[model samples]
Target: MKYYQKALYDEMTSFYLITCDDEGDKLGRIRSLIGGLVRKARQVIGQEGDDKVRIHQLLQLFYGDWGFHCDPEHYFEAENLYLAYVLETHSGMPVSLGALLLYLADSLKLPLYPVNFPTQLILRAEVDNEVAFIDPWNGHYLSQAHLQKLYEGAFGFGAEISSEELERADVNTLLNRFRQLAKNALIRENRNDAAYRYIASLLRYHPEDPYEIRDRGLVLAQMGCYQAAAEDLQYFVDQCPQDPTSFLLTAQLAELKDHFSELH
Candidate 1:
């Protein structure tokens, strides 16, 4: 099932009891809040009528109070700030704030799309099919060039990356981001347990990724699970014959009599 479907189902179930008892009042309040928040957001953007402003301007109004902190890791902090602002400034419900923003923008015929970026909760707006990324915390609009520079600094300039790579980041990407976080924590603390959790998460998200399979094999080998490591390495080699690491691991496994030669 799609992630949003599951989320909608859960939401409906939670409010089912309230709806049953006071359907009219419940819906009326929801509509009122949505209408009010939409008007407020539009006013903040200095937009008259339905004319759309840049995505960055929307973000800036959303988080204008917070000073400049552009790091991706500060996403949760930004979310919290927005939540507090909604409650204090607009008398909005916390449970519906994110949904309201998404819905209201659509209602206003805006081009906003929810972005599940790596280690961040953000939104994007498309104009002429080109996406402009929005940071909800400081309300900064991040350009494609900005994203490219950020990736180059982190992953090296030779790394080939594009906005298309970020266009449809789904549950798998979320799992990978969480796994990366766990791996970073492991590196900082030198904890085997943390590393194991990351490996497990990576496998769960991409059971068929050859690189992940090889990584799991390496972890197993380190844990002295030679038999299991051999099996994984054998599978990796079977799936990707061109990988040198897989071939080397397969040869090592063969010496231990755990390699299945026919598989390769």
Candidate 2:
């Protein structure tokens, strides 16, 4: 119960509760899940005072005994965003899986932090003054070369992994990434209403963010909120004139206005 760890736990739990539509005790359920893992992890790590050994055991508990893994086939499934669903199904995309790993690492008193890496969510672990990067999709340790390869894959060849890219992400940063991922997944699945909810939530946290505004506009258009979509798209085009997507949105705005005029 360090202050930062508790704050992160509470924030993540609150976000989970906010996303649920049913009447169940989402907080309690999440607490129970983490509590069970904590107990089991403690049992496995008993008398093993080595931080490295404890980390290995915890990974075994998570990836081996508990069977958490990435589900690549249905990569954009909206259900993969929830911790409860990921815990139950043992499969989730990177963000949810990374969050779960960070939470468990906190409970087990391991020095782990979330890294909001480009196009992936990863963890940074500190053991005995040495740092290691972990791929949360699986509990594999990543070398600087491995991370460089990932960075190049995302940003094209010759891109290098920078210190900023590996910096520890604060809780707010992690939550923002989670919501963005959720929004995109929902949009990909054609669940426009759900996607809109995520966009709205992000907007409340980061008012008038141009990218989110654009995403909101896209979701609104899909849901037939043409006027709102047009307004949002217009705002984005006006604010970010040179953005790569702004030109495309400019065209979309013209078409949207035409469609609106036709209706009128």
Backbone clashes for every candidate come to 1, 0
Q: What global local distance difference test value does model 1 have?
A: 0.51
Q: What is the C-alpha lDDT of each candidate?
A: 0.51, 0.77
Residue-level lDDT tens digits of model 2 in 8-98: 4454455556556764466577678878877787788763478788778878888898998897797778777776777678888777777
**Pairs with steric clashes in candidate 1:** 59-139
lDDT of 1 by residue, 1-264 (tens): 323312321232233322133433444454465466567766665444433354455555545532223334432222222222343443222122333445555545566655555435455666776666765444457777776676677678876556566674464453344344434444344444435555665567578887677666666666666677777778888888887776577667775454334334
Taking all chains together, each candidate's TM-score versus the true structure is: 0.42, 0.89
Which regions in candidate 2 have their CA more than 4 angstroms from the true location? 1-15, 23-27, 46-48
